[model samples]
Target: MAAAPPPPSCCLVALPPHAKDGLVVFGKNSARPRDEVQEVVYFPAADHEPESKVECTYISVDQVPKTHAIVISRPAWLWGAEMGANDQG
Candidate 1:
């Protein structure tokens, strides 16, 4: 028998100062025509006040023959971090 293929890598998105309160994660599956997965995670403020930086990690268990991508968006108050697979994968 053949060994099972390794799981696909995970996708991560970082949020800059401001929009740290709300974080939404979007994922796409191979069979689905559109995004079939949606997740939301809330991170507490660092010191009672609103957080300025936030980072999130998303992993896909539903393996597909096609590539997997993650989309992240937030309010104008927040910004995105400049990271790559090397940061976490």
Candidate 2:
């Protein structure tokens, strides 16, 4: 069976501009599908490296920019993210 589509909303909670300390604490907890496994992958920032190919879930783009480093957890068979942490944080 195919997966269901996402709900029609941005996932953030909407709050009035004047609301202060209304929702300072937030967290997430989710379970991976039983058929899938995930692993951690890191992409280092290389501003002056030769142009190369990047393989994504559906297609291969000929040139992709890697100006900022990132660490991501992803499925072993796919070339995308399950969760990611950027270089800054």
Judged by TM-score, which candidate is best?
2
lDDT of 1 by residue, 13-40 (tens): 4455434656533342322224333333
For model 2, residues 1-89, the per-residue Cα lDDT tens digits are 99988654223333555347654332233355657877878899876446677678899777655567998877788787767778886
Q: List the residue pairs that clash in candidate 2.
A: none
* TM-score for candidate 2: 0.52
Q: RMSD, model 2, all Cα superposed?
A: 7.0
Q: Model 2 Cα displacement at 31 (Å)? A: 4.3
For candidate 1, the TM-score is 0.16
**Cα error of candidate 1 at position 39, Å:** 0.8
